[model samples]
Target: MDVDYVEYEDYTPDNESDNNITTELPFGSSQPSLSHVLVAINILISVIGLGGNSLVIWICLWKMKRTVITTWYLSVAVSDFLFCAFLPLEVFYMMTSHWPFGLVLCKVTSSALFLNMYSYVFLLVLISVDRCVMISFPVWSHNHRTVGKALGVVVLVWVLSALLTLPSLIFRQTTVRGSVTQCYTSYMGPSKHKAVVLTRFICGFLIPFLVIVFCSSVLCVKLRRLTIKSTKPYKVMAALILSFFICWVPYHSFVLSESDLKNHSVEVLETGLKVGTTLAAANSFISPVLYVFIGNDFKKILKRSLTSRIEEAMAEDFRTVGLNHSKSKSMEIVKS
Candidate 1:
């Protein structure tokens, strides 16, 4: 029941044997170099993404009046912003190229990533369900979808996501392979590592992914069957769902099925994982563009912002011209 990558490709383990292995990624030869590159991108994404998602949260909570629709979007904005904020610590590991942060942070940071990613997924599912409910029972939904209840749901989602991600916290370890250090979950023993990884893949990506797809499909069908043409909100919702599918499906796909379970050759899997990781960050940007930027109020604010800048520039230009004219007249008098 050896759980080595070479063994995972061909051997089948008994139930007891499956749980015997570890997930702590062994450090690699190029650990420091890889960490530097990953750290740079992680920090860059966190800074830019944190600012953008903050604007989203600001617009939803303070600028735009909150309705049930806006409430759901605001919830999603907060989730994305939270992910962006804590993401810098992930780069901390990358900066050191080793998880010098120790067992506690290794567990916390990776667990937080899983929590945020799943929290976002479940929120999207909630939004789809809320839309369906509104369409089917607008009056009832209006009576019940209060801000307090929305807050409660968000709290529950985070709690549940954190619980699901707790194992990473519990088992997260910094491992060394030769000189390279990597932050990842470690199994208790070698015999069960592959099994643990496979299970994690299913739980982390597959089940919730299937749920999202099913719920979204049902939602689209319900909307399409309506007796009237879809309105602006529905169109926007559709666009948001489409963006979610495009941006995230490949990421999960790349994660769950990227490599053979027992193959020690993580080179291919790691390469694919990096691509998915980058794509996942991109999703933090797309949702706001699809949902917020297209709003009438958003457009008006953008236009006003642009206008203000233009006005300031014109005033500065006038002042410059006046100064030049005055200086020229003085020179002419002096010459005469």
Candidate 2:
């Protein structure tokens, strides 16, 4: 999804000055009640996302012994939790249409949001590739897919995400308009804005999306010949990929429409854009549901207690890692 059209701040690709940053829809517009609705939606999203992702982070980091998959899940949960942390500020901005937060904080919040977004998406791509590797070359994956290697990849993703988000931190400024202050990205010129948007679309969305789709498709086909035990993880991963698309495609579509052409007078597209923002924010919470609670094993354990579920997830992680270790040793012995 284009971060430019994100709900919190106005996205005016026009060569506007730092002081004239757009915040809300036009004055006396028909959607006076829209702000109230957005506040409610964002509040709900914040509550759910914060609660769910916090729990996932705790379980993955403390309860489970580290594994490649657990490490990825931990990074994702941390990112989502941090992202949702800023939603209240968004809610406040929506209600009052003012940014009490200064320039530094504005950049911080915006950068954090995008940082997590790219990190989460890339992590999903990594998971897809990991699953594909495990399915395609089980022995090779067993030997190579260590927790250390996974952490290195995650660190690299964080660095890349941070670099990508540098533009938001640099360009986003807090400008005072009349009595109200608004925080927004201040593009230097038309060409620069276009370049940033195009780069973000390709690097942040399109490339990671394609990688995930291709890897998931191949893993799905390979799952047909695998045992049920091996198949379950791949199935869960496929569901995760599907849920990501369901959540993000609307947002990116709105971004594409807004970026490439003039805004149409059609009210439906306008309404769809707002709905797309809400859904995109909601994705932070939806991930935990799809990745954790969707499985029957998790649900059954969760019924007993949160602790039980954590224990069950941890056991599963260790069990999988232990099996891979044993398999790798056995293969080495056989080859020797």
**lDDT agreement of model 1 with the native:** 0.59
Per-residue lDDT of 192 in model 2: 59
Predict model 2's lDDT versus the native: 0.69
**Ten residues in a row with the worst lDDT in model 1?**
1-10
lDDT of 2 by residue, 160-199 (tens): 9989988888877776767877766656554556676677
lDDT of 1 by residue, 57-116 (tens): 777775667776777777777767776776776655544545555666666666655666
Q: Mind sharing the TM-score for model 1?
A: 0.70
| lDDT (Cα atoms) of all candidates against the true structure | 0.59, 0.69
> Which number leads on lDDT?
2
Candidate 2 Cα misplacement greater than 4 A, ranges: 1-30, 266-270, 296-336
Deviation in angstroms for 45 in model 2?
0.8
| Native-to-model Cα distance after best TM-score fit, residue 188 in candidate 2, in Å | 2.0
Error of 1 at 73 (Å): 2.0
